[model samples]
Target: MSINFEALDLRAFLAVAEAGSFRAAADALALSQPALSRRIQRLEGLVGGPLLERTTRRVALTALGRELMPLVRRLLDEADSGLFGLRGAAGRGARVTLACVPTAAFYFLPAVIARFTEQLPEVRFRILDLSATEGLDAVSRGEADFGINFLGASDAAVSFDPLLEDPFVLACRRDHPLAAQARVDWADLQPYRLVTVGRESGNRILLETALARENVRMRWFYEVTHLSTSLGLVEAGLGVSVLPRLATPQGEHPIIVTRPITPRVTRTIGIVARRGRPLAPAAQRFRELLIETWADKVLADKVSVDRPRP
Candidate 1:
């Protein structure tokens, strides 16, 4: 046997593996269901064992399938980067769309975008600075190639690669009475009027769920839609806000300061991509850069935070 398999065969396998649904993978690739099945079958036969365990309700990768996934991704990545798989050199200067929550978009993305454009100068970017829920929808619907989000870790349609744990912290003016404490408790915030997002916001939901167990009732003095708005209100001495550490000012602000609030409520921030879809070469490269850059930075920040005081 020549042992030859086309790129499409590998792609078919990759799609179904990511999707966990033959129909979804087929639709993504614009192939008929039976045709997609035949492709998967042909690829499986060439590989010398059953790659996928498929039934009516679910489709999962077998042991061999798990082992082969990285190899398949690498092969496809190489093809997409070059002119062979793409439609000529036009793809060399493509637009990469990314969805991110507002805070991440503002604080994290500028550095990554600067680093990415240094190498791929012609590559453009479309940043969808959406809310957490909207960001997940963008990536799932393929509007964005990827997202930096704190939600979607459990979403069935997307894969989440966690980058960091962003803890909720108390944001208040430096002169506030609670700011004198090294760390504040939920009960301590009871007397002060709280600035918070609406009930429907993901952050609010995560917060309310956690605080419920502690019987910590917050007094909402002002409710804003965006985290930034809450911060702005805090800066103006309106009210204190509890928000993710990432959303807080990093260094000494003239008025605002952040302190860890107990019990800690943290969100796992990560990269989210649609299951079973392939990113374009430019998008793929940018995603890789973003992960590498942020992962190392977060690890360094963690180590510094963990280092004992003198």
Candidate 2:
């Protein structure tokens, strides 16, 4: 049967079912008992079924009532979510929470954030520096609006969209022998002590997997938490480390040289958001800014100038 339902009446039904008495439901709904009873009666007439088995002492759902309750609850929940989403969209000036890998924060996020601030001065940002796994978790848990992480071929409860691919480079002291080479292979790295990021880091994992494929091994001198720390160790001639090209600071350091690794390896960086969930307006605006900045400043410049004029 075709039935038109009012949200207020549905709310009344839910309250009666939960409170188990018309008086209690009316009190909870902030309506008189007679008004509440009239709402329930109107709803029951529309559905053409006795929803609740009511008596002088108690109230309980009939078989049809039990069947209809779940659908009514779902309808109310969807309506509430829709209203909340619309309100959030209307309040476009709200702050956005973004989580990202530390390296992305250091090397990639700054320029995007600067551009975003210039355009959307009224918008606020809350940034969290987390590892790839932690960043993914934050997005999945609804703690972050979006996350920047290293992309890989794995199925998780979040949606990932590749933004850029940054190649790996070998960083070492300027005086080190390998620094002078035009290009170095994995085997050439075997002699030097490696000051690497922790194995759990996405960068380290990619590097290790590539090295394993080539059957190349190096002496592990140290493991550090931050890329800057590893760069510092490499600059001090403590060891050489493989780092993303973007993470390598520009200009000459007193003791550091950066070189491309032959048979180049790269990591995919991407934007991650909760799967099957809509993004808030602020978050969507921030994401657009991120992509625009990356495309214009980072990816566009990195393209080869020698390629046939396209």
Which candidate has the highest TM-score of all? 1
TM-score of each: 0.68, 0.64
Q: What is the C-alpha RMSD of each candidate to the true structure, in Å?
A: 17.0, 14.9
C-alpha RMSD (angstroms) for model 1: 17.0
lDDT of 2 by residue, 58-166 (tens): 9999999999999999999999999987865644577888888877877677777787777666678888888777887888889999888874225356666667778
What is the TM-score of candidate 1? 0.68
Q: lDDT score, residue 137, model 1?
A: 95
Model 1 regions lying over 4 Å from their true place: 1-91, 299-310
- Model 2 weakest lDDT span, ten residues long: 301-310
| Candidate that would win on lDDT | 1
Taken over the whole model, the C-alpha lDDT of each candidate is 0.86, 0.81
Which residue pairs come into collision in candidate 2? none
lDDT of 1 by residue, 257-301 (tens): 899998888877888888878888888888888888888756324
